[model samples]
Target: MEFLGIWIAAFLTLCIYSFLYRDNPFYRFAEHLLVGMSVGYIIILTIYFGLIPYAWDPIQKAVTGEASRWGFLTLIPICIGLLFFTRLSTRHAWLIRYPIAILMGVTSGIMIPNALQTDIFAQVQGTLNPFSVIGTLSSFEIFGAILIVIGVICTLTYFFFSVEHRGPIAGISKVGITFLMIGFGSAFGNTVMGRVALLIQRVDFLINDWIGTIF
Candidate 1:
């Protein structure tokens, strides 16, 4: 059964990779299969992990006297969730906006602090403490930290349009542009390397696993 699964996986991988040559039925079949499977898996997970655990179980416990009356309050969110389906009805579509507004407000309230902490506060804290590592880290590590601090300042300066880019500012902004390009190029290279890694894995399976099993 494991060998059979390997063969099936190899065939599907080839079907997906076939798009590199040209668009064809095999590629479309593999693409649709992947999307359909992903959606179906998500639906199953939502029902089992989300709906049953958070909604249905609580409602059941409340009704059966296994928990306090507060458990019944779960129905409130369930009703709000059901309101999302009202988008299908033209006359009642406005009901969907209530849930959407609540979702957006609640999500933003939760995320804003987190975003600030991670993106702004954390970055500032790290940048400000570059010299703190001097006692523990080697000279090269200290130098790298200093370079990071310089790169961050330059990048932020490049975005500061309030100050006119003149003389010193212009030179600093040009250096910022170089750092930005390097960051972008590194990101692109990592993405390409990730894809190449997947390709290598597939090629290895074809050569060593599937072909070896058949022979």
Candidate 2:
């Protein structure tokens, strides 16, 4: 069984890597199989790990008088979940909006404060430093901080559509564009590095584990 699994994995890996040469049926088959398996596994996990443990068990306990009234509250989410199935019916598809709205409202209510704190407050706090650090900051640190502050101001100014980009505004906007380019380049480099790392891992696995087993 283990050897069979290893051969299957190796075959699938080769199938996927075939895409590097050109698009082929082997790659497409592997990709579709992976996606279908992922979706099926997720559905199974949701039924067993999520619905069964949280909703089904609680409702069963409530019905059996093994749990308190609190257990009955689990039925609320179960009903909401059932509403998703209504989407299969053309006439009842509109009902899906209720669950979607409930989810959106709850998620937005939960995430708004967190987003403000992390994206806004935390960033502002990070960008600002006390002048008291004058003695602690090296010349390089001071220069870097000034550059960051300038970059931020220029970037913000670039977004100001009220004034036309002329003279000083043009110069500032150019600086802003430079900073944006640098940020984008860094992000692309990181993405490439991540993919390279994944490729390296797969190659290592094929060389050390999979092929070694055969030998």
Candidate 3:
């Protein structure tokens, strides 16, 4: 069974590799098979992994009086998941909106504060801590840190539509834009290097594992 699985995986890998030659029947078949299997796997996962263990088990326990009152809370998520299937109904499709709203509300309430804390505050903190005054430590590194903090602040300020931005603020905003561009350029360079590394790794793997074994 394990060998069969490994061979199946190898066959699909070769089929996918055929795309490098040109779009052929094997590649096309593999692509569609991948999509179909992905959707099937999702359905199976939702039913067996998600719905059964999370929604059904606790409800069963609650029914048998082996659990507490909070076990019924599982029903909320269960009903929400079931509501997603109601898109098949003609007249009662509106029932899905209730669950969607509940999900969105809970999600936003959790995400918004977390995003602000992690993204905004953490970024500000990182930029601000370049110069810690203990004795007499005035360094060019401190200047760079201060500039980084300033750029982050100005860039954010430029996006602030609520207040009037003029004079130095406009210049600062431009500086921020420049800083953003530099950061993006650096990130793109890193991404290109990463892709090259992955390509080299894949070639090494193919040569060592498959080509070496076949010879």
lDDT of each residue in 1-215, candidate 3, tens digit only: 75565457667778888999999999999999999999999999988998788988898888888887688899878778788877789888888897889989999999999999999888777776555551344677667777777777877876876757778777877787888888899999999999999778767756665565567
Model 3 residue 42 distance off true place after TM-score fit, in angstroms: 2.6
**Clash pairs detected, candidate 2:** none
Clash totals, every prediction: 0, 0, 0
Order candidates by TM-score, high to low.
Answer: 2, 1, 3
lDDT of each residue in 1-215, candidate 1, tens digit only:
99999999989989988999999999999999999999999999999999999999999999999999899999999999999999999999999999999999999999999999999999899887867667988889888998898899899889999999999999998989999999999999999999999889989999999899989
Q: Estimate the lDDT of model 2.
A: 0.90
1-215, model 2: which lDDT tens digit per residue? 98888879989999999999999999999999999999999999999999899888998998999988689998788898789999999999999998999999999999999999999887876777634476798898888888888888888888888999999999999999999889899999999999999999999979987898989
lDDT of 2 at 115: 99
Better of 1 and 2 by lDDT: 1
User: Weakest 10 consecutive residues, lDDT, candidate 2?
Assistant: 125-134
* Native-to-model Cα distance after best TM-score fit, residue 10 in candidate 1, in Å: 2.3
lDDT of each: 0.93, 0.90, 0.80
Once model 2 is optimally superposed onto the true structure by TM-score, how far is the C-alpha of residue 81 displaced, in angstroms?
Answer: 2.6
Per-model TM-score, in order, reads: 0.86, 0.88, 0.79
Best by lDDT: 1
Pairs that collide, model 3:
none
